[model samples]
Target: MTSMRALGRDRCLQLLASVPVGRVVFSMRALPAIRPVNHLVDGNTVVIRSNLGGALASTATQSGAVVVAYEADTFDLDGHTGWTVVVTGTARLILDADRQARYERLLHPWVDEPMNCVIGIDCDLVTGYELAPA
Candidate 1:
């Protein structure tokens, strides 16, 4: 039997901050879609940048509630030990000038068009799991 482990907020934040890339999940027309994104943890929120196109941008603009999942795992065939961290939370578009500026400093846009938009997810409800050699 395999046992599941529950991770605390501190662990979740630590894992999220350590990784530079994650997957953002959202629904488009009742269909689930996942996109890879580069994010940064700002205090209790995760900030990411994107261009004007894409389902993520459209969903955020439509004021749709989205669940952004940031996950990371490590595994070795010989060691048979690894861990995974997952963070799920509501997502929204960042429009405030001050907040946008701060997020911009923390998350640099890698794409063209200056990444005229930003998406943020508050880490109000975050959970994770880990499996390692005991």
Candidate 2:
């Protein structure tokens, strides 16, 4: 049997901040798409930097904002003990140059691509669960 423990909102954000990489789920061409990207946790948001004119940027550029679900998790293979966190929010492009600069400095892109666009996702709904053997 397996048991699940709910994590507090504050603790969920703490876990999110501890990780640098996460999967962002969005809609592309009416289909669900998942992209693994590196992100930084701002006060109440997640910041991701990508190519200014890339496909990922268009998701937020074309529309004022896009609904997305971001997730980060880790589990012990042998122990079957781990935690998973999911955050659902609206992702919007940060057009302000000043704020973009600040986010860029905080979230460095891992890929060797010219990342000039910033996407900020508000961590409005945070849910996390710890899975362990019962």
Candidate 3:
């Protein structure tokens, strides 16, 4: 049997930083869209690099700070042990040159494309669950 437990905010953030990739859920054309991107946890924020022409970047730039959910997880099917984290927050483009440059150095794109945009999601409420052996 397996058991599940709730993870606190700080613990959730730590788990997020341990992972390399996650899904960023945002709105496009009034519809929900999800993009898989690698990220870095900065303090209590999640940062991702994206192409300037991408839908995410476009939406973020046009809307300023947008509400979104960032989710990431890892699990072992055989063992039924792992954790899932979902973060609800506001995302905004890092437009300042210095900050953008700093993020550019800290984050690397997984795809072979130019990622000219750096967005930060300030975590407002972080909820997570961990499954483990009972």
What's the CA RMSD for each of the models?
Answer: 2.5, 1.2, 1.0
Judging by TM-score against the true structure, name the best candidate. Answer: 3
Candidate 1, superposed: residue stretches over 4 Å from native = 1-4, 64-67, 76-78, 112-114
Residue pairs in candidate 1 whose N, alpha carbon or C atoms collide under 3 angstroms:
none
How well is each residue in 1-134 modelled by candidate 1, as lDDT tens digits? 23457778898788888878877776788887787778888888888898867778877787655666655555565766555666777888888999988888878765556587888887867877766565
lDDT of 3 by residue, 1-112 (tens): 8899999999999999999999999889989899999999999889999999999888888878889899999999999899999999999998899989999988989899
Candidate 2 differs from the real structure by a C-alpha RMSD in angstroms, to one decimal, of 1.2
Q: Pick out the ten consecutive residues of candidate 3 with the lowest summed lDDT.
A: 56-65
Error of 1 at 27 (Å): 1.0
Candidate 1 lDDT score at position 48: 85
Of the candidates numbered 1 and 2, which has the greater lDDT value?
2
User: Which window of 10 residues has the lowest lDDT sum in candidate 1?
Assistant: 68-77
- Which candidate has the highest lDDT of all? 3
Shift in Å, residue 16, candidate 3: 0.3
Candidate 1 C-alpha RMSD relative to the actual structure: 2.5
Estimate TM-scores for all models: 0.83, 0.94, 0.95
Best-to-worst lDDT order? 3, 2, 1
**Model 1 — TM-score against the truth?**
0.83
